[model samples]
Target: MSWKGFSLDSATSERRRPGASRVTAVKILIAGGFGAGKTTLVGAISEIPPLTTEAIMTAAGVGVDDTGGVPGKSTTTVAMDFGRITIAEDLILYLFGTPGQNRFWFMWDELARGALGAVVIVDTRRIEDSFAALDFFEHLGLPYLAAVNCFEGAPRYDAEEVRQALAIAGHVPLALFDARSRDSVRQTLIAVAEHALRTLTAGRPRP
Candidate 1:
């Protein structure tokens, strides 16, 4: 399949017949501020129907939940989003999307345990909303990629400009994507995986 602009090889290649016992699983976290498309992304790329724990917005959150940039949003994730995708015959990715509201932030540490890396989705209209998520990953020293989710009417910024605005280090990868597209989501995942792999190898002792 073609993701972003690159073609991916067939996942059927280099695989044992059905029932092979050598499959490897990698955990990936999808994190962002409220209304940044975390749930949308997990649903788009999951092989199975994604599991979500969304609750309707109500008067109770009128003053507490910040709905400035996402005025139309009516639901929020209370727990987490879960999904799975098989990128290759032997490689499976387990996706866990964190709850975006600050009240739900306590769940992040549990979800991040054993995760290979994360994709921090950003909404250009509410760029500052993502700061907490970015700081969370940085403080843990986790390798991650910042993915700017393009939305209709949102201002467009070049990669360097976004990097500078977000104060992302030169080593971290940054890219743009449409979270609703399967190809785009796959491409983002590829970037995260590549970044994590590089960081892992770099920390290892040379042979």
Candidate 2:
């Protein structure tokens, strides 16, 4: 077999399967408010079929959950969504989507554990939707990048203004992304990996 034109054969294959792509695993958390398109982004960029655990909204979950921010949003992630993408010979990113509704907030830490980093997808028209994601990353001390998802015909705001409004630090990586595009989602993962690498290498955190 061959991976990216690198053949795996002979003694190498017998021993360790050379050039068939190494098992380099990296966990990345995909988080945002309800209907921010976290699952779509993961599915768009993933090299494998995305695994999603979703549930329908209920009447009891109405007031307890923050529906004000995501009026147009209907469904929500219940357990988690999983996806994968191989960026290079060794850069394989695994995306785990967290629940967006406030009721599922208890699982935040478990979902984020051992993650390389996280991407906080933002709905600029409903910026407050992403507050939980921001708070989770900040409190957990997880290195993360913020990507503003451009909704169709939604009002726009300058990146700087959004950052300031969200109180996101200037040093934290930030950019605009479209969850539906493979290229766009891939870039977001790249940004996340790069940011996490920098933070880990700087000795801020490990594993």
Candidate 3:
């Protein structure tokens, strides 16, 4: 869609509830490999219209960007996608979807600053494509969960099987979902928030 600048005051006014306590906005990053449905997940779950910077793929990117698994994909997210959702009367979530290509990964360090956690979306067919994202988050020690986006006609695997294939840690949350479904996306976000909160609590220093 169209792009516009974001402001805290404006976002608060739009998402605030009557007689609610002060708002707490938590930032989360949506990350994955190219064509893994990061943009679609944000758009499906966001209350406000999502801001996206997408450009049509051209011959120029043929050598640089790999399109082996997703040959039909014609567009790419050139920058981050922004969206907002209210989890409770006093709690809001700001979602930032990172650009998937390696070249755009430099922006992730900035996008991930102050983020409470992240969601790594995976395509079953291109499971290997998500390794970079997993490594990035793990290296930075950011709390995150893995979501397997069920694409049509794509091979399906159970959560445990996928987790083993990805070599995800035992404590990390892993789930299956369809990015296009609002309910599924919402559930996935809830899982991520729960996992993040647990990690934070566990890491707290004892009094």
Candidate 4:
């Protein structure tokens, strides 16, 4: 909720482990369309209290912002959300959640600069809303996985069906998760990390 003690500069600084084990810090982006739950997912899984830049929705965004599918939503992330989680003693993940509105997209390039990979959260109710995120990561050639956030009362589809609908590459990992659950989100993050590692490995030049 507040970033009083945390700064991006300090958060990304090298950390030392006093023993033989070394610590590796990873940056990950949480991206998706408006109201797709990027904020919620980060908050649920973050070990530290997440930093959020949410603002109340107003009449000024009436025509520019679309909230039809998420009629009850009244707030939006105006900037990025920051959070940290330790996957292991040697591995820490720093999450950056991008703002979903078109006007804030210019910040994506910066948020994604050092990110190892991304998790594209999707809402089946507005499945089409996820296309822009998919395209952006694909164009950047960044390794990422699609995560379908199963909101209550929303129509459900199996993983394969959703994958086909999204038209993602067959090898890309696809997962179904409840964004509100810490366990579910943790599993999703692990999946993306593994997927990204495999992708990096496969692309390395053979010795």
Against the true structure, whose lDDT is highest?
Answer: 4
Off by over 4 Å in 3: 1-18, 204-207
User: lDDT (0-100) at residue 132 of candidate 4?
Assistant: 94
- The sequence of per-residue lDDT tens digits that candidate 4 reaches over residues 1-207 is 111222233224456677746566778899999999999999998999999999999999999899989999999998899999988676788999999999889999889887778999999999999999999999888889999998788899988999999999998899999999999999999888777766765773211
Estimate the TM-score of every prediction.
Answer: 0.89, 0.86, 0.89, 0.90
| lDDT for predicted candidate 3 compared with the true structure | 0.84
Q: What is the C-alpha lDDT profile of model 2 across 1-207, one tens digit per residue?
A: 112322212101222236664545677899998888888888888888899877777897856766665676667898789998877665567789998877787888888777778999998867888887998788888889999998686668888988987899988988987889888888888888778767865777443
**Tens digits of lDDT, candidate 1, 127-167:** 99889989999988778899999978789999899999999
- Please write out the lDDT profile of model 3 over residues 1-207, one tens digit for every residue: 111122333222333447855566778899999999999999999999999998999999989998888888999999899999877666678999999998898899889887777999999989998899999999888889999999787899988999999999998999899999999998998888777767765773211
lDDT-wise, the better of 2 and 3 is 3
Tell how far residue 23 is off in model 4, in angstroms.
0.5
Predictions ranked by TM-score, top down? 4, 3, 1, 2
Give the CA lDDT, 0 to 100, for residue 25 in model 1.
66
> RMSDs, each prediction?
5.9, 6.0, 6.3, 6.1
Best by TM-score: 4
